[model samples]
Target chain A: MISSIGILTSWLLFLLLALVFITNNLLKINIYVRLIVFLNVCLFLLLEIGLFFDDFTVSYISNYSASTTPPLYKFASLWGALDGSILLWNLTLSLFMYFYLKNFKINTSNVDIKIYSSILFFFVGYTIFSSSPFAGCIEANEIGCNLSTLLPFQDLVSSQIGRGPNPLLQNHPLMAIHPPFLYIGYVGMSAPFVASVSRLVLKETSSEWVNVAQKLTFIPWLFLTIGISLGAVWSYEVLGWGGYWAWDPVENVSFIPWLLSTAFLHSAKVTKHNNSLLNWNYVLVGLMFLSTLFGTFITRSGVLISVHAFSNGTIGTYLLIGMLIFSLLFLYIGSINRRYFISSEKLKNKFGRSGFFIANNILLFSSAIVVFIGTIYPLFYETIFSRQITIGRNYFDVLVGPILLLLIFLMIFSIKLSIKNINLKKLYEDNIIFINSSLLISIIFLMLFNRSFNLVVTISISFILISLITLNIIKNFNKKGNSSYWAGQIAHLGLGVLAIGIILNFTQSFSQEIEINSFDNFIFSENNYQIYDIVQENLPEKTELKLPISNGKITKFTSLNIFNNSSQQAISSPAIFRNLIKDSYISIKSINNNTFKLIVRENFGISIIWIGLFITSTSFLPKLKLRK
Target chain B: MKSKKFSLILIIILIFLSFYKISNESRFEKWSKILLCPVCQGEVIYDSPSEYASDMKDILQEQIKTGYTDEQIYNFWVTRYGERIVTDNIARNFEIILIPIAIISIFIIIFLRKINAKK
Candidate 1:
């Protein structure tokens, strides 16, 4: 019965969205938007209710939730799978549209509503047709049927049991919150996309759209940063890999859009200030939105192998076709409206602030292109050469590394330069003290502690960046107002800190495999580690092995969980002991009759990365509040 | 003028320092990163905790101990498990390297031309 209600609500939402495009004149757009939002809320609530009640009659609940499942897992199971995540996606899109329309004055001729509603219409229609969570399942099948398969209501009634959530997802609490933040970040790009498209289509030449686009991009960019950071934290704490980012295809897809949105944010600032890079802003915003769609395509489609991808399906082909159609439509509109993209004022000085912004955009955009190609190259290579090849961390480190270095350089100098003036002499004089001090510190530090050439370069660059940004902040400390300037500087300082952490962690981290008997002590890297106890806990559906290890100062517990489900999967959760300078990470590789093999790694400067990410993400809060 | 000269001298010193190359990774660390875990999805042998990855690491260590060259060890893996086993193929492929360089250079040229055109 609840499954039927879900399907009906989705269909109602789809029809209401379609009415915005079909019957444009019959009802007000606000009425249609209201109906769509209401139906989306209803659909979302219906799924939540189904999961909460353990309604085995609904296939989604039966597949993901069991009677013994915790209430939190049951709630998170709504977005734990492919079909339900799309439902969450639709609900997020509707909420964004409802709130945006409430604040902005969108007119009848404004293609913003139409474009926005059409995106909603496409997702709602996709939920109904391609992958509906409301589909029923059969009980007798040994393995559960494909999730997207729609069965009769009579068949679902026969199934009274559920398989429970994906053991990997329910293993940690981070899984529940990570996907929501990421989805909000992904769906939030549609706002600027719709605004950019409508602005191009209507040929509006005012700078008002720039403000709207910047504000829209800034909020999503903050969420994307937080989401990606949380995902890294989850990967480190949960995956037992002793590392955060793996350059996996899914991670790259999400990061690709972020790179574009960040570039757009920078270029949009230039356009607002100097009325330049107008055309670039439009294209960047458009790409930012489309890349989100492409990200969804890569995640849902089984073409690329990713640790984070859902099960393979035909939904990928449909999403690709949809992406192609949208790209073509955007190209069509952009080409016909090319003349309006031309800015009245050209960049007059190569050494001015706008010049640095332009260079920053180039480097960022090129890095995005490099990542996008590296991600999809294997698919192309497989098709043509009939061989499978993996593009891993080495590929990105080589190609995108130099570009990032150049961007960091630009970030430091761009702050000191004026918008329209070219004054290298005065700039040098102003920053000479900072430059000398940073160079001196870098030289001394490298002489004392550097292990490799890369470490030396990274240490030197970070010192320069941090010192320069601090110099800026100190110079501007007593001056009132310009909170935006302070925010940007703080964000840059955070990036510097994050860069230092990443490089230090990468260079200095070492792991060793050691076999230790119970209650035995081992020595690694001059730190003595002793295993205190190994405790096994029996839960309703799983067995967990918790190992407590101490390094004479602190004890941390690392665990391995073996699920009692049909798949019988096992996941190991690493324990990290963090301090002001570094983190001591330990994970269980395997266990044999009271003997445990542990991978103990000393991760240097990891705490600094989290602190940096915190400072950077919160810097946007003041800017966001000022937007209001 | 003094600050400009100091900056130029500093740049030269930095450039000269960057050319001093040293090997930071051991043979085991390097080879473990280049080879993928046969059973895991896109994970290197060094990072994966699976039985197969551990076995691969053992074989690699044995090869290194037997006085095998890097090329000989890499070839042994390629023969055993095709070209897909190597995780650094994109870095080794010369044709793929040119594309990104060309794209970045083109962007730089366009940006420089736009700025120069104004003057």
Candidate 2:
């Protein structure tokens, strides 16, 4: 069978499970259905994996397999192709099914519970039946060196050589873990969203539901944030791109959900603060789930274009159907409850955390809306206008950057305002005095050595630092078990530091386009880059010359590129250079003379972003630890 | 909650306005020649430097600059790349195939419901 048939079978199996789940009142089928569904998922995953990993004996496998492909890469290669990647997607979903089936048991005879089961069924049915990883190109292969093909897979096999994976994917170690973590985080949050929907439509509202549900949502959000950050770091360092977040539609798909989830996190707080907003909270949580499915739809459905999309034609369409159902069904359900949701009278507290919470949701929604427009606008253009208007960094930079800046500004300023009016004079007198002193000390220390200085940035940071310190002191002055309170303060402080890093790093970045061999004179950003010496060398993996580079005597680094490799004497790397957290770009065009070659400009700045990300990543540690 | 909602709306409007202003000032930097070639898929021809994925960056940048209201640019590329413009190709047919199916199915359910209610 082609990939399509296998995936369709998998969908049928999930649908079978859904039927069993719905009829649980009539038939004792919980354990049996779980086992059957698990087996079905496993079967689909295997067949899909086999489509990539098995030999030419299997038509698709032989066509894509290669001799030089390593074992680890061979397995990872399962996700290397369009259909193969869908296989991985199916597997991630299946594993999620396993986890949820084990922990969460549905109480039978409830139609809402049936709806929940069917929701999952919709996801599975769409994934397997339509977007089958085993869809097409079931071509047989002949074993030889890829027949001297120009676009053949790689250096390994001859005419029959199967390409291992995208070279960029194979080059990095993080490739193995990043996609799985990201997908898990993406799918894992579905349960919380589902449970919230269950609680809402079932009209079983309680603080216990909120407490239980928030934990489920929060943990996944934490992992998803970390996963997204790690992915950014990977792209920055590995892709050799000086910058991360190029505003790809695929990246926006991942980001949109995160934005909605951020709203979910905050709106949950509103539910606790005001009993009236409980329905809004449920709707928001459901929307978060719908956003995740929408992301999957964007990826699987082929609505968005990017490197991250994987569509097997009809599978994608099935998913779109599911997404449409999800959106419309939930909207209808929520609208039916709209009358119940209306406030008898609106609470107008101009000064409180509730006000901030509301502001946070709208901005988060605003951010999501902007990204959604940017992401899908191209698809609309292509489909309706028959145009290929590509939305890129410029669009996102223009649209999203300011919105994010606004969010950050709110996040920072939110600290200053409180729900209840308090004695600000006493608080400032106690903490601001010391904070301002520290700020003065640090500002002086920085200005003397560094040429660039900003008083507003320095002062704002002082405010953040002081608020954090004061907040902590206030929260745990008597060693209270309320570390979660301190966790919020520290996390906000980390974001403030991140803002500082962004500003400082952006201010200091320098670049100049010059060839290493010919550039005797170097001038960039009021600083001169000097190349002292160049020596050709050979390595086990690659061959190139080492050029010693310096900016005055303060900086020393090596610049090089491979023109040959160990196995194939002529395998040359596109001139690239790197460090763990930072990258210094080098583009070698051609060696004109023995000593003269053309090269592009040098650009580097991952450290600032990643370090900022690291700070943001660690901010979660306190929160996770505080969770009981 | 009401006050907060108002503040949030106000903040969102301001943010949108700021972006609208920025969009007005920004210029599109198209690299269709370097980022995308009519012949190839998933390859950006610009050279990489300083450990910077310049080729990919150029490609991505070009994709982004596809213009906010790029009715003209998008149409031109669709003619150029055909359906191959996007390699994933999953979501496109969904608009054609599934929307109709979903609509048809929904109506059938509604019709069946009405009959049952009459009975």
Candidate 3:
């Protein structure tokens, strides 16, 4: 009964809010917004109450939460399944809308709010109609109740116990936070999208919206960078693959928005200066928003088979239709306001700072396109030819790799060109010494180490980028520079560091699967290790097999957890020994009588990737502060 | 002029140095990475921990021992499981490469044309 009431109340409230905003163009009523936000909060609290109380009467609670689950995991279970995640997504969107309305400037009209509220209403209605967590199930079964349409229920069987959260999700704590970060990043893109759409709808020609959009873009971009990196870290630590990025369809979708938003940031920066990329900024913002929707659709609809996709539902079609509606809306707005997109000034120099910014935008956008195509091509091929094909990491490595390298090279010179009155030739003249020294150092290092082709190229470019950044810091350390300038340099440095880490880890990492007898020693990466003991523990929910392997000085315990669930799934937790230089990862594949197979991997310079990601994402902090 | 010549020389040296191979990766390691595990959702045989993947690896090893070349092995998998099993069949889908190149080139050309019109 409470679930039904919650669903009806939220549904009616969203409908009423959308109607109010649509009817009253000048509606600045804070009370209405406050009431909606408060009620949304209450709804979330109600769900949490149900989860904590283990209310099997509520289908979502019974399906995803159990009494034996930990408190943190109980909290995280709200987003573990399809219905609850949509609710979470709606909550995040509402919060973003509240902040956006609160921070709206005076000159900005209420149309933006109307469009934004309508978006919220659409999502809320979609949730209510399609995948409402509050919807009651018809009959209880061993697994759970079958999802029924939105209707009032007499009463569910309260005697039924709840199934716990997915074992894979509960195994790692990172699962608790990763989705929220990605959702925040995904939902925040709507702000810039709304601002741009409203700008076009109002036919406002001033560049003031650029400032708003740029500020809006950065927060989401920062969160997205962190979100994607945290995801990489989670996969590396938990997936037992000894690899971070797999270029999966779902991963590519998330990255596409990040890439597009990055392009928007640069182009919007240029638009603020000279308005050359005004139309381009609008298109980029639209694409960024569209890509997020596409990502959500891909993840939820199960159109493409990805490890991260949720169960198949009708919600995918709704989202696809939503995408269609928004695309048409964007196109109509763009066509009517096409004249307003023309720039007042022309780009004079191809090698100037603005020019490089444009080039950067192109590269980023092109890479986004490449990833989008690579992700969707398989589906298209399957539909057309009735055959499945896999467009995997190698496709992306071949296509997007050079673009990233070019972006890094552009970073090396763009900073130098930012100085006043410095042409390309003049910038080159100033940095020639640093460049030559960097090249020499890379060549000598390559000779000493004797690395692969990919490593040689990455090391050379990374050295050049490092030299450029160091020189720029030495030259500008005492001088005052804008927050964006320093942020750009730090982000560039982070990119360089991340690139080097990725390449080195890829080329230098070694993995081997060996079957060894009990207490037998094995040599891996020139280190001798032997299994000292094996311990097995049985818990209420799972059985764990722990193996303590020692390298004469220290012992590390790696365990395989076998869950006593319907799936009987087993998850291996790798024991990773980390230092400043490399990480030694060991995991047990399987064990038989008197013997066990171990997958041991050595990843070099992997720590630098995390350091680089930290630096890169935090580089936006000063700029965000400036926004305040 | 001096910087341009110096950069040209550097590029030449770097290109020559890239061909110097040092890392030793076995043929099995190379082929396992591009072959998708039949049971796992997007995981290559090189990374998947499923029993099916392990069995596939054994079969792959047997093929190698039977003197099958890289192309022959890939062809065998493709024939058995269709094109989906081979993750990186660039030879078959050449248009995937061309489409991106064409899109990027179009963007560059349009950009340059716009700049030239302004000039």
Candidate with the greatest lDDT versus the true structure: 3
Query: Between prediction 1 and prediction 2, which has the larger lDDT?
Result: 1
Candidate 2 lDDT over A401-438, as tens digits, reads 55555566566444445556434565445555444444
TM-score versus the correct structure, for each prediction: 0.94, 0.70, 0.95
Write one digit per residue (lDDT tens) for candidate 3, span A266-345: 87777777667666777888989989999989888988887788765788999999999998988999888767766535
What is candidate 1's lDDT per residue for A316-421, written digit by digit as tens? 8878887887788788878876666554357756667777777778888999989988888888889999988777788888888777777766677746767666
DockQ of all predictions against the true structure, Cα-based? 0.41, 0.05, 0.48
**Residue A334 in model 2: shift from native, Å?**
1.4
lDDT of each: 0.79, 0.52, 0.80
Q: Top TM-score: which candidate number?
A: 3
- Candidate 1, superposed: residue stretches over 4 Å from native: A23-27, A139-155, A158-160, A474-483, A566-569, A624-628, B1-24, B110-119
TM-score of chain B of each: 0.73, 0.29, 0.79
lDDT, model 3, position A519: 84
Candidate 3 runs further than 4 Å off = A23-28, A105-108, A419-422, A447-450, A474-478, A624-628, B1-16, B111-119
